[model samples]
Target chain A: MTEEIIIAGFGGQGVLSMGKILAYSGIMQDEEVSWMPSYGPEMRGGTANVMVILSSERISSPYLKVFDTAIILNQQSLDKFQDSVKPGGVLLYDPNGITIHPTRTDIEIFQIEGNKLAVDMGNAKISNMIVLGAFLKIKPIVKLDNVIAGLKKSLPDRYHHLIPLNREAITKGMNNLKPFLVAEMILK
Target chain B: MAELKLMKGNEALAEATIRAGADAYFGYPITPQTEVIEYLMEQQPEKRTGMIVLQAESELAAINMVYGAASTGKKVMTSSSSPGISLKQEGISYMAGAELPGVIVNVVRGGPGLGTIQPSQADYFQSVKGGGHGDYKLYVLAPASVQEMSDFVEDAFDIAFKYRAPVLILSDGIIGQMMEKVYLKDQKPRMTNDEIIEKYGNWATTGKKGRERNIITSLDLQSEKMEKRVHRLMKKYKQMEAEDLRFEKIACDDADYLIVAYGSSARISQKAVELARKKGIKVGLLRPITLFPFPKKALFDLANQVKGILSVELNAGQMVEDVRLSVEHKVPVEHFGRTGGIIHTPEEILEALEQKIINNGSIRHHKTRESSIL
Candidate 1:
């Protein structure tokens, strides 16, 4: 199966990093993957977005007008990409930052308090990891151990101390997402 | 050969250059093409193999530095995207006039004036025909896959040195950004500086000596000598046409409709061909791997066999003129494409083929009638 996801937010919000982590996870899973970013002036302070496509077979076009999933970290990003989600697809939103509710009934929306969960875990910047943890809950395509391994491979040896905190953030975020998923399943 | 590893196209290009015995890489950072410079910087091939890597002040300076390096018979290269490539045209012309061997990579982006930061095949004419002033031609190689991206660098460098001309890898943003598996080759041994001087010491400007006075200049004041020099360049081009024409033909023997495309557009066109076949149409693709010295003979042969030809590209009708020239009124040639960074979908191309080929209406009739009457 092929999964196409878009991770979008304001610059410095780790949107690109989240996309990279997913791409790395795909690589670990032995799936063909591509991570493409929006170039030019848009990368400065404007919307920074990346498209990550993971497939079992060869991928055709890297440019997608409609994405199967969108991980939005801010209200602007949610407003920007809500309309582009494919029918019956998934939309993961950081509830702490995003105030705008999705208007589409065709998509399944999951809201996580990513920033609050990360702050409670001691590293507020680990909001990206929190969202990733929620991603793992919704779509268990890659093992949590594989993600930890991917993160370890990406981080420098000098920054190894941060690994434990990151792991904690992920665990805490995953624990916080269970109630929501069960409720969503019951609603469905 | 080694195990295949997932790698970006620019990284593969850099790795391939090192394997191809490249001695120098000079370039500036540009979108889509920056990874090439980044890979070279991170790999630091020079400390291991004595290669030269320099981030020049501008694309102009980078190409001129390449000119200086190539004059000494060293395998030198530089890379950039559209606007930067436009800046390097003057240096490219100078290199052509002096008959130097070098490799250039153009990871093209949308353009006319910074049109977009997306992939584009609009630089077809700029790279195939001479973008730089003066009568010149670059041996342009278009690679569709990441594997081809790595493999073609060696071929481009070999052909450049064989004919004493510049070779260009014409790539787009998609190829630059996309990752795919590539098999890295074992490093090739390269010639030392002394060895290069010993071989091409006649014209290289290393330094002035008592007996070795090497001169490297493109200026030729004498009209007859300049004319003779141009003729020599033309002769080299003709030789390349005979020896270095590379293309791929897919199920084209009895193809009623021929789709002429290259690079990323060709990849999409291949899918279009499959869709056309499912609908009971005998469609095939003619993908030109080498854009310059364009596979005219292949198209000419196919023209007599195919009922119609469709030129597909990411840009609006750029390479279509060349396809038209090759067919030369023997068959109807139609063009379908998108511009300003929009990628053409396989469904859109199939739709055009259906209207122009399967339908085979007034357009084909008019062409056939005119040809018979003539």
Candidate 2:
């Protein structure tokens, strides 16, 4: 199985790190993974993004036009990627700073309350982890244990103390996911 | 045994340099490619393997430093993006003329002047067609993956030292910034002074022990002597073209149309090949792994079979000229590319191949399009 994903948000929101951890998790499962981030001056604050491909086979191209899953964290990211999701693909997002919601009906739109969960966890930095948790719940692309292990491995030793909290935030994030259903489509 | 680890292409190249026993890295910081030096500084191979990592104040200083280090017959290296690489071309030409061995990693960004710090293969002409002064060629290797990014460090050094010439790891910002699984090579110890003298004492600046001083210079007032040196360099390039030319043929067997690309464009073109074949177009991909020793013979042979040929790149039809020259206009040669740091999608490539090459095969001539659409 191959899953092409884009996780996009503000520069300091750990968007690239989240993708890196997910890619590392894929490696732990003996899969091929590639993580490509939007770098340069814009990455400092102007809506950073990363393209991650986890494949059981060889990955072809790091630059992907359509994503099987788009983990949009802010209104800007959602607006940029809502229509770019593939048909029957999943669109996971954080309802933290979002104003306009996704408009697509062909793809499943799932929202994780990352900001509230991170606040509950008493660590604002784990917001991306929560969104990752919601992504795992939908795809199960990698196991929960592997994801936790991957989070620990991806972080440096100095930041090791935050792993447990991040793990908990991911679980909370998985539980808080709100699936945009047919009712919402009919309402629209 | 080297373990498989996940790494960005830039970091992987740094680690590879350490493992390859690179004697020194003299480089300047550049966007989209700065991670090479950053990783080297962080790893501190000087402590681990006695390799040197020095950040020069400018690209000019860096390549000159590399030249100085390489004169001692050590495995020296330098890395920079497109514009910085342009500054290093003089030093590279010096290294080539002096017949010193070194590796220069060009993690290419968009170019012309101070272009954007995004991935682009616009440096194809500068890299493969000799950006530096004088008629010289660098053994240009293009890596499409993080593993190759790391692995080619060793290959570059091996080829560089073997022929006493410079080798270039001609990569782009896409491969430089991307992260993927890489199986690192086992660490090689840097050569000792005694070993260096043994291997290259004939020409290396090894204190001139037990013999008259061996002077290294790129100058010869006599046109006859200079002509001989130029011929020698050309001969070496001919040998490399004959023996070291490398390419990857992707599903070319029984195909009617061929898409030639390198680096990131090659990877994307592979996806385009799959999409085109799915739509009943018999297309395959030809990936040039070594850009300088360019697989012209292979391209010519393939041109005889394929009904049409399309060269895809992140620049405006640079390698397409080489492709056109390779087949000698036997088959229709066309180029589809996006420049100024823009990358083309597989669907766009497929559409171009279908509309511009495969379906329009009767137009038995060369054509090109500047990518204006997103």
Judged by TM-score, which candidate is best?
A: 2
Worst 10 contiguous positions by lDDT, candidate 1 chain B: B197-206
Worst 10 residues of 1 chain A by lDDT: A178-187
For each candidate, what is the lDDT?
0.83, 0.89
| Candidate 2 C-alpha error for residue A184, in Å | 2.7
lDDT of 2 by residue, B238-330 (tens): 999888988999999989999999999999999898888888888989999999898888999998788889999999889999999999877
Per-model RMSD to reference:
3.9, 3.9
In terms of docking quality, model 2 is high
- When summed lDDT is taken over every stretch of 10 residues in candidate 2 chain A, the lowest stretch is A179-188
Ten contiguous residues with the weakest lDDT in model 2 chain B:
B365-374
What is the DockQ for all candidates, taken in turn? 0.28, 0.87
Candidate 2 residue B10 C-alpha distance from true site, Å: 0.6
Clash totals for all models, in order? 0, 0
lDDT of 1 at A75: 83
TM-score of chain B of each: 0.95, 0.96
Candidate 2 Cα deviation (angstroms), residue B323: 0.5
